[model samples]
Target: MRSLIVSCNVTVDGFMAGLGNDLASLDFIVPDSEQENALAARFREVADTIVFGRQTFLDMEAYWTKVDSDMAAWINATPKVVLSTDSGADVSIWNNTTLAAGDGAERVRRLKASEGGGLVMFGGVQTIRSMIAADLVDEYWLKISPVAVGQGSSMFADLPERRSLTLRGAKGYPSGMLDVTYAK
Candidate 1:
């Protein structure tokens, strides 16, 4: 079975988006070069499906589809499974996106067990946290951004249960980014 990976960027202070992330300064949807583009492409090659939280879906809707980069658009358009209560309109670029609710862990487990590639979480901090608390995340791709939001949104779920991830590897980017991969 393929692994469920929680991938996102965070700051040095352990905050994913400061505290609230209302400003959305932490998101790096804008990759400026071919190398970074290639790196993301490589990651996508291992990932067959991309799971998204409602808020993350909205955020993606606000930015990615409007983008001009074919590579970035292709990545965003990749199979996105959204877990949200909002009945928002779907973007044309996100054609394969589906809405899923209730028993997220079980659904994700089913997704992993079925025939496909690895599953990667796209922003959904709550979803990621819930899955993590449920011991669902098999891998993590944390791209640490240099900026700090001071008080924005958090990446991990505020669950009563906690889990640990084993650091696999980390590489620094020219834009002061550190991509860290972990496994549990």
Candidate 2:
């Protein structure tokens, strides 16, 4: 079975998006370091498919489409599965994306059962919450930044029950950002 990993950039206060749903704070915290590059490469190697919520998929599609970097190329080339209820969603703008409509957990479970590399999920808050509530996430790779936003959306909110995670590893960068990996 392929593992489902929730990879996200989070603030010190545990918020994924700051006031007004801004993620600009994350840009200042990302280090131009070899460790970060290696981490990205590792995730790319492990996951053949990238999963997203509808909004995230659309956002990434708009942003990454014009970029020329390796990350952009990889993201554009890799298969993407967007979980959405909108039957009319036009995913054609993205080269390799498909929209999955129906039960979110059931679709994700079916994806996990399929023969392939690991699946990586980037969230739009509600999607992450639903996955957590359904106990569908196998691992979490959180890049904890130094800044804290007083008010914002939390990545771990609305969980049905307390979920314990075993710390697999942690890497700290010069920029004060910590890349922590946890296993369920």
Candidate 3:
């Protein structure tokens, strides 16, 4: 079975996106450096597939497709699964992409069983919460930024119950971000 990993960047206060539901506030964190580049490369190496919520998928598609870089190439080539209810939306605009509708948790369960590599989820908040509520995540790879965004969408909000995770490892970056890994 494949491991379902929730990989995201969060503020010290546990928010994923800052106020106004934008990531501009986080621009100060995770500065562009060799370390950040290597971390991204590491994620591309470990995860064979990228999973996204509807909004994030759309947003990423719009943004990443325009950029010309190795990460863009990897993301464009990667097999992607978007959990969405909007059947009318065209997921084919990108290559190696599919839309999974109805019973998100069950679809994720089947995907995990059918695959061998890691399934890394980037979020729009609601989708991650759904997986958490269903108790379906296997690991969390969070980069905790030093600054707190006071108000924004939190990474672990409205979890159905307590989720106990063991600390797998942690590393600090010169950019003042703590890369932490936790497993269930």
Q: List the residue pairs that clash in candidate 3.
A: none
Model 3 quality (TM-score): 0.88
Order the candidates by TM-score, highest first — what do you get?
2, 3, 1
lDDT of each: 0.70, 0.83, 0.81
Q: What are the TM-scores, per candidate, against the unseen true structure?
A: 0.81, 0.90, 0.88
Query: After superposition, which runs of candidate 1 have C-alpha atoms over 4 Å from their true positions?
Result: 20-35, 85-93, 149-153, 156-163
The stretch of ten residues in a row with the least summed lDDT in candidate 3 is 28-37
List the pairs of residues colliding in candidate 1: 18-152, 19-151, 19-152, 19-153, 20-151, 20-152, 20-153, 21-152, 21-153, 129-157
Which candidate, 1 or 3, would have the higher lDDT against the true structure?
Answer: 3
List the RMSD of every prediction in angstroms. 3.0, 2.0, 2.1
- Candidate 3 C-alpha error for residue 109, in Å: 0.9
Evaluate model 2: give its TM-score.
Answer: 0.90
Using lDDT as the measure, which candidate wins?
2
Window of ten residues with lowest summed lDDT in model 2: 24-33
Give residue 156's lDDT in candidate 1 (0 to 100): 60
**What lDDT, from 0 to 1, does candidate 1 have?**
0.70
